[model samples]
Target: MAGGDPHALLAAAADQMGKPPEGTPRRPRVGVDLGTASCVLVVLDSSDEGDCPVWVESAGSGALQDGVVVDFARAVATVRALRDRAVDALGTELSTAATAYPPCIPVADARACTYVCETAGFEDVTLVDEVTAAQRTLEITDGVVVDVGGGSTGVGVFRDGRLERLDDRPGGGHHLDLVLAGALGVETGEAERFKRERPTDALPILTPGLHRIAESIRAMTRGTDADLPLHLAGGALMIPRAGDVLAQYLQRTVVTHPHALLITPLGIARSAP
Candidate 1:
């Protein structure tokens, strides 16, 4: 497995969005991430070294909240839009895809994620846990994978390439936006834009929220091995020095990546068979 330069793979994936590299595998695997703040579609080359993303697209969506499908119709529409965008960019009909849900959600709720893909015109859909999908992208054999998305933080502990424990809680970028909105006296949408575009300016105001997330991580991993480094895989913690804040707060090793948000989505595509 390629271990020395994970960030390079992530950067390559980001750079290839909407324009896949030439000579990529003809039959690409697809992943649909129905997230709380956005829906992402990822296509990856189907080959021995297929982990790199070929095309990726995301659309802001309120269809899901905290990993649950809240607005079913909007969810389907968002996935359909993402699918169409990928098809247009890749020039191929994407009929099958893999999607994921937060760990420990009810089976029915998780099936709802698969149904979103099926409704969006996918003929074959595979459902995987979000954290495992992240591991597929990070390729971490023994560490904690913490997926901090827009609405939730999912923690998965793996030992020897096997998942040992999985848990999720209600807190993420959305909550941080709430904090920023309140602090800056701006609308939530404005807060989101500011959080992304002016993250450095917003980080000081958002530190408390980030610490809350760290506390959630500490709680989730209470009984797990403390020595395992925390590998972050989601957009919520992409701010500069956010990893340092987490490390300082938890006093544990924390690993982060560029385009952290795409980790789970790309892994979902890898989960496809």
Candidate 2:
């Protein structure tokens, strides 16, 4: 957990190994998240001035797909543009940074996220898994960290500060979009906006989809820590009733945070060395 070289970083702390953070004001560590639907960069300040996490910026483009860098040029340009914006806003050249990937993404894909940062001109790079990163920020010790983002859901089981198991698979908000698309006979994009704008009205319609995600979690962690608390992280579950749907299905306590979408990205920044 101390400042160490990149190789010294651990798998347990990978989620938050090198991303921006919350709570404590720490040195400005940058975190780049190459998400399926969006790419985000966050920087946290330790010694600067105010009590805050600095350098929170994100840009959405069809660059990365399902947590993989598809269009390399678009990914590079998106990250580069974000870096420039943060540099201009913070008045500091953010050369070194950390980034993260889905819990179950291959090591090569995880490294791809780190490369995205370095290609954008970061000198130092730390790699972390997305769910672990979320737990770092939430500090969930004996519980499940379920990250439902645009592309997938990552589940991490932790006890006594050690992650017991980690797994992830696709089927997130995007999947829900397909459901809505079929129901409403519209494009997935339109359903996404509909879910965001009218979630209260949309929850009933999306119940089956949300339950599907909940059931995925139930199947993955069926026997272990069945009673453990569930901390929700990511944007997909940000739907108003998603947590309750999970609670009803899982019969366990489910946690939701303000700005849940930033949970993993912010935790990734905290992973910085």
Candidate 3:
């Protein structure tokens, strides 16, 4: 397997997201991510550069918790809205999509993610694990891809571009919000805002939570190659210096990307057939 530069792919994805070209030779493929905090829709051209995102949009929804689709109807509605927005922006109908679930969830729960996309009107839906979806975007031949989302941290160990091991644990941005909320005497919503808008002030208060997440990674990747680098995806660790904090705690190289939150969603699109 050939290793491609994940940083370059992420940069291109960032640049192309939400800005589809006027006309292209191939139709666009779609990826839908039903995250605990939000639902994202990503579209990409089926051309050679399909790795780059063509259109992207997100909407906050409480249909999921810890990557499990709890409110089936709400999840379907959220995805429908996102798909409609992408179609309107690109002036193309999106009939097929790929979606993902965290690796820790039961197989039945994972199927809920696919159902949501299909219920939202997608004629064809592909299902993949969240960690594998992220790998599709990063193309990391040998490394650890960690997707720290609102409710869980999913780790995927890869060698020669094949997934060697995968695991996920509950503990992510939402847990950090709880820690910050307790420390600052604020609501969880306010804590989330503070963490994002004033990370410098919030990082100190949230370090312990970050460490917990790091420990989860350490536990999940226990038997994998110790020297492999760690690549970060998902939004929880999008805070400035979060990667540095993780590296310092785990004493391993950590690779972060611009628009880290979009990695899995874009990768899900890449999985579309």
Candidate 4:
């Protein structure tokens, strides 16, 4: 198991993006995240200390919507390209992988993620809900795990290292992009680029969208432990004050990990067999 402080694990994973670590990698595990905004592939090498990430890559290909495979061929192509690049960089063949989906989606839709990985050349594919995968990385024994992706927000409640509740709602970074586009009178694509390049300028415009996501979290986690801090995962709320807005709106403690975007992708890799 990758045992350590969750933030440290995330930072280590962030450090490994596109930069292979020293020495021969061992017990390589791969995770594929077919996000609405992009498809991310992560490969981790297992050791006595923990799982250290060796390779990380993302494609700007938008083939998924709300955690469902909307364009299977494009998703497959994107994953295959990531796999090829990782293979070339690591000098090893990755045969198995783990991927995730939103909790509210139908089972059939979740299976489509597996099919994409299989078609992308993985011999074995493991399927897990996006929230659970994030927990696998955060190891939140008694906190709420909120994964806000480009298309949806998935929530997981944990107690004593066990998941007590799991749910998701449709609203995330893509929704924020739409809001920003409307405010700036620009295309959604342009809004997305602006949000990424100039988040300081974009934060004020996206506050309502962030609040909507916070509302989704509040709704999904109504009955869970209210005292436990909300731990945010995924890339949607990585904007500077986004977490602050969530914390303020919800009136609950919010733990925003560094390299927030890679949390779920790294968790998916840890879930790989």
Candidate with maximal TM-score: 4
C-alpha-based local distance difference test score of model 4: 0.89
Candidate 1 residue runs with Cα over 4 Å from true position: 1-5, 20-25
Give me the displacement of residue 161 in model 2, in angstroms: 1.0
Q: Give the candidate number with the greatest lDDT.
A: 4
Tens digits of per-residue lDDT for model 4, 1-273: 345777777887777777764645679999999999888999888877888788889998789987888899999999999999898888888899999989979989999999999999999999888899999888888999999999998888999999888999999989999999999999999998999999999999898888888888999989776799999899988888888998999999999888989989988998999
Query: After aligning candidate 3 to the native by TM-score, how far in Å is the CA of 162 from where it should be?
Result: 1.1
Candidate 2 lDDT over residue span 83-162, tens digit each = 88777666666777878888777788778877777888888898889898888777777899999877888899999999
- Lowest lDDT 10-mer window, candidate 3? 1-10
lDDT of each: 0.88, 0.77, 0.86, 0.89
TM-score ranking, high to low: 4, 1, 3, 2
TM-score for each predicted model, relative to the true structure: 0.94, 0.87, 0.93, 0.96
Residue-level lDDT of model 3, residues 210-269, one tens digit each, is: 999999999999977779999999999989999999999999999988889888988898
Task: Tell me the lDDT of model 2 at 204.
Answer: 86
Candidate 4, which ten residues in sequence have the lowest lDDT sum? 16-25
TM-score of 1: 0.94
Per-candidate clashes, comma-separated:
0, 19, 0, 0
What are the runs in model 3 whose C-alpha is more than 4 Å off? Answer: 1-5, 16-21
Ranking by lDDT: 4, 1, 3, 2
